[model samples]
Target chain A: MDTTSYNNPEQGNQEERLWNYIDGTATATEKTLIEKLIESNAEWKEKYRELLEVNQLLQASELEAPSMRFSKNVMEEISRVHIAPATKSYINKKIIWGLGFFFITMFIGFLIYGIGQMTFTGGEESTLTKNISKVDFSKFFNNTWVNAFMMINVVVGLFLLDMFLSNKRKEFRKQA
Target chain B: MSTGLNDNEIISKVLSGDHQAYAIIVNRYQNYVFTLTLRMIKSREDAEEVAQDVFIKAYKYLADFRGASKFTTWLYTIVNNTCITFLRKKRLDIQSLDNEHVFATADNIDSGMRANIVEQKSKLAMVNDAIGLLGSDDAQIITLFYKAEQSLEEIAEILGLETNTAKVRLHRARTRLKEKMETHYTEEVKNIYN
Candidate 1:
């Protein structure tokens, strides 16, 4: 909301704008206009007085302060927390990026080198295709145990992620 | 990380192994945090626990404080959040249309409001009672805005509200506060007249 703009009401609907003026958020021109309007218009004057009274009352009372030992108890609790050192606490993004760059460069360089030195193990067949040709897919598909194991791992991973996310959500709610 | 330093500086010191420096932060912000918690929770004992937990959380996560906001604002966020979490866990936040927090502060005030101070005390008590009648969010907004001395923008950020939304809420809250004050004060006046 462009709240800083001067809102000169067109008609009988400037409550929000009037509130902005009362909140001291109105532009200078808007403030001048509001002051003039409050002076000339009885309704505006009454509304302004009501807002001013409420503002004063809200600003009047202070909440109760805790006992003298409040800080002491906090300090005692803080003494037990294991604070991580500054350097180790925040991860270095540069290192992560550098490692990523290094790995990518190495993979590309090795690929170029491997491609240059490549020789087909079978006539007109690359090493990858030759290797694929040697694998038997029938035994793996025929076995239900392998599928069950994979499904269990998937379910467990999902369960773990769900638990982790739920805990994170709870922490976030607490923070909010 | 200097020993005698500002809030961010003290936090840095605490982060950098000057554990004792946290005492400075705790001492400085305890009352403000306590006041906020006390208002929200409406009980001294629970407010005390919430206030202590606020500092502890701040201490534990001092490193995570991005310093995008003022330290007091950040600390207050913790205080408010802790109170809310405490309320939920304890399930003791029914409104009950009561004025315990209001009258409690009233009792604490102006024992020394003496003769000249009596009128002022009465006025203050009326206002305070009106404040007590406000909802937790409204009362919290009043406390944060006036007592904590935070700007509307800062309050918006603290309360996860848009600036306009916060302004509207504050305006409505104040309006409600005024109604409560006037209603109670009028009743008192009538009683006196009677």
Candidate 2:
């Protein structure tokens, strides 16, 4: 009986260690210890040989290659995802210019509305001192210039609201 | 090997929109991936599909790969999971040695003599059949250890098991395979000598 075998007689219990050994997963220290044991152990040596034979049989087995369309299919799926969206030059350019003009017009209109409201209110408060609450908009509506300005304001407000709503919808769609 | 770019370098290039850099990674590991998938799925069609899925998935998740381990290790983890999922969906039953005794015996003789012209083909088929008999975990352990050449530590990480556990699973799988082989051998010998 080999001395090493006498020391480690239960060879079957080391089957897991043998697998780790074949896989090169054992730590350096553990590997050295196992190696030293194998050197003096006949049973371990025999077990190692049997495992090596199986390993070789497995290695000798040929692996069949996948079909040529494999990579192509993968690329196709990836392309569907990562490929950039089509560039719409006309629509994009139009939207950019339209947004710029819309913002500028809104700014000017806001400034005009602020100034007009301040001036009109400041003058009306003093001019209509006699029961201003009872005063009606009939006279103001009869004045062509006042009515024309009011009508223009309403149209511009509606136009601005339409643009704002449309832009909001576009943003929502983009998020969706 | 010195001149070849490492996986990290290739990954950086890919992230920077060097789309073609992906081919390098694919070429470098395609065979390993193909072999692993083939061994696991056992069907050429399914294996090819799974292998391609693995590559595509690895490509998509490349940015999330934090370099905690080798790229091959990470990739095998994905491949292993993909095959396992496929196997579950297919609901393939484990092949039993008793059920396949006749074919297994013939295959054993064919494999033992190693002399038949179709020995390689038959042996591959037998292994595949035997692998089909094993539980999913055992089959995966056998493939990762023997076919993919993955270390037990790497397999542990992939399978979410302790290193010792992976080793034990591998040992058990091998023991089962050997027993299967032995039974087939005995049957074949009995037939021949009697």
- Highest TM-score against the true fold, candidate: 1
**Model 1 scores what on Cα lDDT?**
0.69
Q: Which residue pairs clash within candidate 1?
A: B110-B113
Docking quality of model 1: it rates as incorrect
lDDT of 2 by residue, B57-146 (tens): 888777777686778889999998887788778886533223464465656665646545333445555555556555556666777777
> Interface root mean square deviation for model 2, in Å?
9.0
lDDT of 2 by residue, A7-104 (tens): 34375567557756876777898788778777889867767766666566666655556667665676667665452322442358878789768866
Q: lDDT of all the models against the reference?
A: 0.69, 0.67
The per-residue C-alpha lDDT of model 2 at residue A126 equals: 62
- By lDDT, the best candidate is 1
Taking chain A of model 2 alone, its TM-score versus the true chain A equals 0.33
Task: Give the chain A TM-score for each candidate.
Answer: 0.46, 0.33
